[model samples]
Target: MFMQNLPSEVLINEVSTRDGFQSEAVFVPTDKKIEMIDRLSLLGLNKIEVTSFVSPKAIPNLRDAEEVMNRITRNPKVTYVALVPNEKGAERALATKADEVNLVMSVSESHNLSNMRMTCAQSLAQFRRICGLMEGSDVRINASLATSFGCPFEGIIAPERVIDVIDQYLEIGIQSISIADTTGMASPRQVYELCSLVRRIYPSVDVTLHLHNTRGMGLTNALAGLSAGINQLDASLGGIGGCPYAPGATGNICTEDLVHMLESIGLNTNVDLMKLLEISRELPAMLEHETSGQVAKAGLRTETRPLSQNVIDLKNRNEKH
Candidate 1:
């Protein structure tokens, strides 16, 4: 029998425009970014991380955050999200009227220092100030904990420390949490344990699982999260995204592949799988590089091809004999 705790429908958050594009060395033109986001909006994603409101020096590719955010046509059914690292980013995100601002930091001290140039405590303090800035506004705050499973510099993050960080985020009045496998070192058991703990301890908070395919366990870990009662997942189109600060890390789990698997397993994601595949197929041309997605290259499991002439001739000869 199937697990009773598994959710019937999972919520997919598309992050190509923010997390995916940030890792590219080549700057994706502002118009292209806006157009891609507009196309993604119609694919039935629950939320789309539109862009990051960061300094151009830090992430030059997303320097056009404001312009992209302003130009993209809003979908009433979709929540537009923006990555905000500090008060300045929060201000920029708010100015663009983003529905939600994702604040990120690392659970590992070494990773946090390398990625944000600040300790976890400093990141929390900055988040507090950002919270104060968003007070009374309609915008929502979501704290994303990077390197939650394992750190490249510091292997094996303790579960207690992750819970402690979540406690601090809750105290700061942030209701949503995103548990990220920054380097994709998370095992299925590790994902299940932490996600189950979070679910049991904090039943009221919203949780999103952001996984990477670096170690080839992204989809497995996602399944573990779902079995642990997590319904929200973050995926990138064409499976393109990784942390620049995390050495040897690869792209995220492919959005089309994940959606295809979910739907195949009798779980509902509400996303248009065909449209998603179409978008995934276009990524290679847009990025000028091949993508990591599988379903896009090898169509859906049900999609079949007709017999070739050679096969037909062989079959006819065998039947004639």
Candidate 2:
């Protein structure tokens, strides 16, 4: 299906700080990261991936994770999550009192080694250690399976490969799982089948879709995921972020654009579109380069504009739906 009768409310987890910044060449000041997170907190965001607890050597841009976490004013309603690679990183995240710890591993062995410098089996071994560290803790644990749809090195990934990792995640007591289209190669049919299959078997688990717009189908794929009963979605502000190791990887689905699409379709995202647009507008000046977001460049549907025949036709068609 091209469109879906979307849920009344959907959870959008902002990952700009964590995933978005890791690829930048310039180091964004800790104050700036805190400022953005604090502002996002007040905007009624469901969750925000604050920072990654990785080594400064891995992603030097986010070296100040501790300072960013400490500087941001915590909002109880908003979940503050941090990415951790292993037990050591999880320990640091726990020290900062992060509300959640997000672990990542690619489903493809080649992609895993390329991006994470570890084989898939080795990555899982490390994840098991991290899981042991989080045992008997209040901190929420989530696993984001990267390259779930397709990999640059490996052409197509089997859904069974993703399901095996998800089963392992569940065994470790991780309830939330994000299947990311690491290189933006997912088709709508592939999205539908994967989400439907995951939900059909793992009825109790919370599945989220983390998609990218590298191929310009992020919103379309998101609609397909929702059509299959996956309500949680991950997006990056200003469409920033790509894997430094994954070949041909690019920024994630733009957060404001996704929200605009959902809101236009009468789904409740609970995000302030005007405020998000304002944020997207400032990013280009802040980053010293044009961002990948298009909504700010193009006015939203509700904006003041002369309606054309094409616009009228679309409106009439949607009304009939």
Candidate 3:
């Protein structure tokens, strides 16, 4: 059934430059990165994940994180968040005047060990230490639980395991939490059940969903999230950013595609679809790779002369179904 009663407004946090470029082989120049952010801002995005402040040895692509942070023409209305893995990374992010600092640790024990080289308990303790270090800083903390849905090394993650990790972040006084499908192992049922549970547990916390399209279920999972009362979503232009560990994994859901889907369904994202499409068009050339965005490849419906009989029939059949 169509969701006519769904809330009209939803927030889309653009993560193209940071999460999108983390896996890119070539380093996008600081100037180009700034240009991309600037353009994205013009498209009416309310938030943007600028870059991560991790060690240069870990993510060489963002070695110029400071440069990218310093160069962008930041919009006063838009919130720019930087991902900081540890206290040192948080310090680097704070120095850049980032509006928010996002901290994340994997929920699965094996994944946590592999990703952060720390146990779940140890990671929570580290986050508590980082929170203490903030000490009246303007930067807000948003703790993300990566692999909240499922893990590659360890198959299914228990719902209680996710809640246990979230409890730690909340106990440390983190107000915002971003639940990430780091390896894109989430399904619609999983998203609905888990998101509802999280919302129930943390009623006042600002929860955001960072979905991945690796299994072609990104949009479906997003709708499930929306039904579960999640309004904030993290998406990348051209569906960028794939897991380095997960073989055959795809990128995050495409920002333009998500926006298009939402708008088509009468949801307001405040994002200009045409301008977003322009950004997606330039992305492949900027990154020098073929993107998988259908809207980008086929163009928007408005660009066509008119709906052909076959297309109209397909739409009719879809509506009838």
Model 3 Cα displacement at 254 (Å)?
0.7
Q: Measured by TM-score, how close is model 2 to the native structure?
A: 0.91
Q: Give the clashing residue pairs of candidate 2, or none.
A: none
| TM-score of every candidate relative to the true structure | 0.96, 0.91, 0.93
Q: Pick the candidate with the highest TM-score.
A: 1
Global lDDT scores for all candidate models: 0.92, 0.88, 0.89
Off by over 4 Å in 3: 1-5, 246-248, 306-321
Expressed as tens digits, the lDDT of each residue in 187-297 for candidate 2 is 988998999999999999988899988887888899999988899999998888865555444579989989988998888988998998898898887777788888889
Q: Model 2 misses residue 1 by how many Å?
A: 5.8
Clashes of each: 0, 0, 0
Residue 195 alpha-carbon offset, candidate 3, angstroms: 0.9
**Clash-forming residue pairs, model 1:** none
Per-residue lDDT of model 3, residues 144-246, tens digit only: 9999999989987888999988887878898899999988899899998899999888889999999999899999999999888889999999998976766
Please give me the total number of clashing residue pairs in predicted model 2: 0
